[model samples]
Target: MKKKDKSHSHSHLAFDHVSFSYKHSDKFTSVFDNINLTIHEKEFVTILGPSGAGKSTFFRLASGLEQPESGHIRLRDKEERHRLGKIGYMPQQDLLLPWRTVLENGLLPLEIKGMNKKEAREKVLHHMKKFGLLGTEDHYPHQLSGGMRQRVSFLRAILGGNEILLLDEPFSALDSMTRYMMQEWLLEQWHEWDKTIIFITHDVEEAIFLSDRVLMLTHPPIKGEIDEVNVPISRPRNEEHRSDAAFMKLKQDLLKKMRSKERSL
Candidate 1:
């Protein structure tokens, strides 16, 4: 469970009437017809949708890997169409280079920016120790467990010092036990760092456990179709919270919403 900052009066990130599309051959596929949403500062928000719901498209848009055909995305208070370097994004797989040791991989972003590699290592070492990855710096990705690899991946994403973190199904590839552990670890990091997080996942329980609010997105060619489900359970959420009466009720509601949304789609 993580403590949430409830003082943010306005959204640190926002999408206003945003519309995006993709082109394949001669066909244009709309991902978002008009998305309007806001995420408050230092809040942990998860976007939940079923399979093939254009979930990845939303992440691509937020990370500036792609752009909307119309409308705008705002960070803090400014419009930034090119959010490329402005966000920290972590894809599902660790994506660590097999040849690089964990330490080398952690230093990559700073190295690319012409930053002093030595300084970057020092900073990362401190965080590694804090993240329980202190002794693994010399290890290659293949040598570490799935959980460890994901931890290293998360460390890489955070090393860039972005205010917001965009995690795309970061724990999906892990075993159930590892996913649970990673979820707990992620909350610890979120609370400690106080960074705003936008996480995407299809798991109802995971969304309930990790987010301040879960945004329900409709099927692709999304057209102003979204729902915000509030997580009323108090922070920091815990194992006890999972089976509690209120939590179960919330989970059931989310399940219903998903099924209904699926039917509609």
Candidate 2:
């Protein structure tokens, strides 16, 4: 995250009584009713739940990929169905162009936005160095490790110039060690960029370790619901934080919520 001046102030992002369901669905829906949440400026929030808890649906609503049946989404002073381009989205897969080099992949978003090659390369180099992908800029995606490829994907997302990031299980595919390393890098970048991030994960531990707050969702089509757990650990959280009492307590609470859903089903 880029450092801002001492006096810089920004409005917190919010979801105000938002509700949604698929367009052709009947009463059976993916999500609906008063789903309210708020993320303070530069805050890191995690959305956690078992599969089918409507996590993806909620993200779609937040990303303006889908519209809510009713209610408003307020970002600062703006409202009224805005497609927030300021948000960077990274889905489960990296979604890199196979033929593109690391640098080219990082600059993909800029290219699509009509930036010239020179301008795009400048932004790409900036993120490459910031993200520790400097020497591999000329390598192809397949030539990099899983973790590095994900890094390139993240660089591309950041190059989109979105301050708020919506990440949906972005590191889930990697091995445990790689996943841990990626999580560390993610927090480092989050601190450096100072961007507001909303990350979705099924991993309770990851949620506790990475977020200022964890929103635990109920089962499918969750509505008017949340178990908002605050993580009070200090910044730049690491493996040690995982064994702390607060971390265990939050993890247990989240597990209980997930187990409840399992039983109900």
Q: Report the number of the highest-TM-score candidate.
A: 1
What lDDT tens digits, residue by residue, belong to model 1 across residues 47-92?
A: 9987768888888888888888888899887999789798999877
Clashing pairs in 2: 1-192, 1-193, 1-194, 30-221
Q: How close is candidate 1 to the true structure, as a TM-score?
A: 0.89
Which residue pairs show backbone clashes in model 1?
A: 33-222
| Runs of candidate 1 exceeding 4 Å displacement | 1-8, 112-116, 129-136, 142-147
Candidate 2 global Cα RMSD: 3.6
How high is the CA lDDT of each candidate model?
0.85, 0.78
Q: Which ten residues in a row have the lowest lDDT in candidate 1?
A: 1-10
Model 2 lDDT on a 0 to 1 scale: 0.78
**Model 2 regions more than 4 Å off:** 1-11, 24-28, 112-116, 129-149, 261-265
